[model samples]
Target: MLRAIIVDDEELSVKRLKRLLSESKDIETCHTFMNPLEAYEYAKSSPVDVAFLDISMPELDGMALSGLLLDLDNAMDIVFVTGHDEYALQAFDASALDYLLKPVTAERLDKTLAKIRKNRGYTAAEPALSVFLFNGLRLCRSRKGQETIRLRSPKTEELFAFLMFRRAISREEIVDTLWSDLETDKALKNLNSTLYYIRKAIGSGQTGDCIEAGRHEIRIAESSLYCDLYEFERLLKQIRSAPEPSADLFKRAEVLYTGEFLKGKSYEWASEQTRRLEQDYIELLEAAARFHIGIHQPQQSLRYFCEILKLDAIREDISHEVIRLYTELGRKHEAFQQYRLLEQSLQQELGTRPDPRVEDFIMKLMR
Candidate 1:
């Protein structure tokens, strides 16, 4: 059992975390402080095993308060509990044991406590770090439910994503890829800061071992990291190569691609790969649509067709198919709406009207 103290400026936050700590068997006594100075004062005389500090506090922030607490007893584990996610680098720099985001869940707190235990040599640390690139860049831990990691800056995210995608990259390549617009000196300095942020974000525990940085080159320890893109593409390959792929296999691969590769981020290097993955997604949707058609489920097939059109509005073939599906499902009005949407999209995007044949086809189907 360990003695723990939580310091947060918000009284509600302190109470909430204290309640969560109450459920933990590893924690013998839990103390709460609404003031950072008071928490520091308490730690001065009474050395606790764990100090839970809120990063954004009044008088003295958690980072500074933690430094003072550690000065008293370096063995004391510091866990940062705060609403802001950007303080990860500072927290790690202060030698914090773990970082927890706001509205802390019981499960996440358990993981933090587990990390403390691992630090105390009570148990071995588990490889819980994972990178999720679909929909956006998400660095998640925990297999049960995601504990997403939010990095401090876009450069930090890009550096981590670049490293994850390449696995290993030269120092020159990193600077060229990420900092080509800046002078060599400034670029190198930025790279150094970004690299430090990456390592700090990963933490100082066993998970830290996943990223191996050297003078000439830096590489990700593939064994320690579980990247969703890797598994997603692997599933796609398996499903594509199979003689007769099952619907279950298609569903598995389809769900893994939550959205286009790194959706919403304007990363030049990722544009090509994003396009490729989108093409793959469109193809998967096409296959699923055809399967639904074969089974006489035009409604289900229509859904897949609409999904494909959402990704590529100028897909005249899919648009025609959607109109036909709507007509066949006894919704001629919707078929006409689909046709008008296609016409507008084609006109606006391609600077050309939809093929006359599409309107003709819709007319015949409606009649």
Candidate 2:
């Protein structure tokens, strides 16, 4: 992983770089400096192998920062994080080894690193692990179906999450996940047991054929699996390939994102998947609800509309929509009771109140 710094006075540019870096788990630290002087101090104290510097600053310019870095004899390298190409050219004039356009790209950064190693003799480290292991090599992969576990390690949960997300993985990958402190033979036994348990879980009810083991590779039995993760990804691909956000796609996403995938699990690999599904679910739920409303399926619409509230109760549109459906259908008592429950839930879980739209719905229903 690369430990990097964004030394630009512009907050937006720094934010963009930080976000792009986040997509790469290879990054360890991403610091933002809004002032040139502060960045200069950091440059002097540390061996900042890769410095993202901006030109046209209040104090020292990007050129000077790069010059000072090389002068430190720390083998520090510089990448110009500048807005205009002209600024990059100016910095290059000051002997800045390399230059990058604004809105730093992961691909360009990779290219820059490759160039640096070739000329300056700086070798980059290997990329970080796709899966992390912990807690007795109980492997879990997200890429696979509720399928069998092929690998076991200290971070088996995270490993399983990865495999669940990915279709297959190999034995060497599994062994590398094992902790160095354990005896090799005993570790393999535990690994087999962990795989057995994962298969049992996947085949428990939904499907009996969800895992396939081979000589060196193990994978999810994609032939007949009902993975929420797989369903969500399929919907995403459909949405992308579609001409527009169709009603069908939204509805599919709504039902597919029933609950946070792997909810209440402490595995780190599932965290990112949970967040992504939650975000997509919220957006698609509103669209799906609208489609259902247009088709006069308010009861079904109400089901979806209410489900959205469970994930994000603050969205007043969903609450109001559900309440109005109950009222217009002459179910006023249910509307009021639902309001009470919603209010109590918000107060208890979020320590907040429902939006005024919810209260207004109660007023409408009271009549």
Q: Report the number of the highest-TM-score candidate.
A: 1
Model 2 lDDT-worst window of ten: 127-136
Give each model's whole-structure lDDT.
Answer: 0.82, 0.64
| TM-score (all chains, Cα) for each model | 0.59, 0.43
Runs in model 2 deviating more than 4 A are 1-158, 166-227, 240-258, 349-352
* Model 1 / residue 320 / CA error / Å: 1.3
RMSD of 2: 13.8
After superposition, candidate 1 runs with Cα above 4 Å error: 1-127, 181-193
Tell how far residue 348 is off in model 1, in angstroms: 2.8
Best by lDDT: 1
lDDT (tens digit, per residue) of candidate 1 on 232-317: 77667555645556666667777888877888889999899898888988998899888889879898789889989988999999
- lDDT by residue (tens digit), candidate 2, 1-367: 4567778888888887776665443456777788877876876776565677887677788777778767874456677878788775577777666888865654565567676666665454321111212112222334322223443343545445656665787755665554345677776666667766655644434433455667778786543434555656656655543434556567656555545666556655456766776777776776667767888888877887887887786665667778789887878888887788778877888898888767875776567
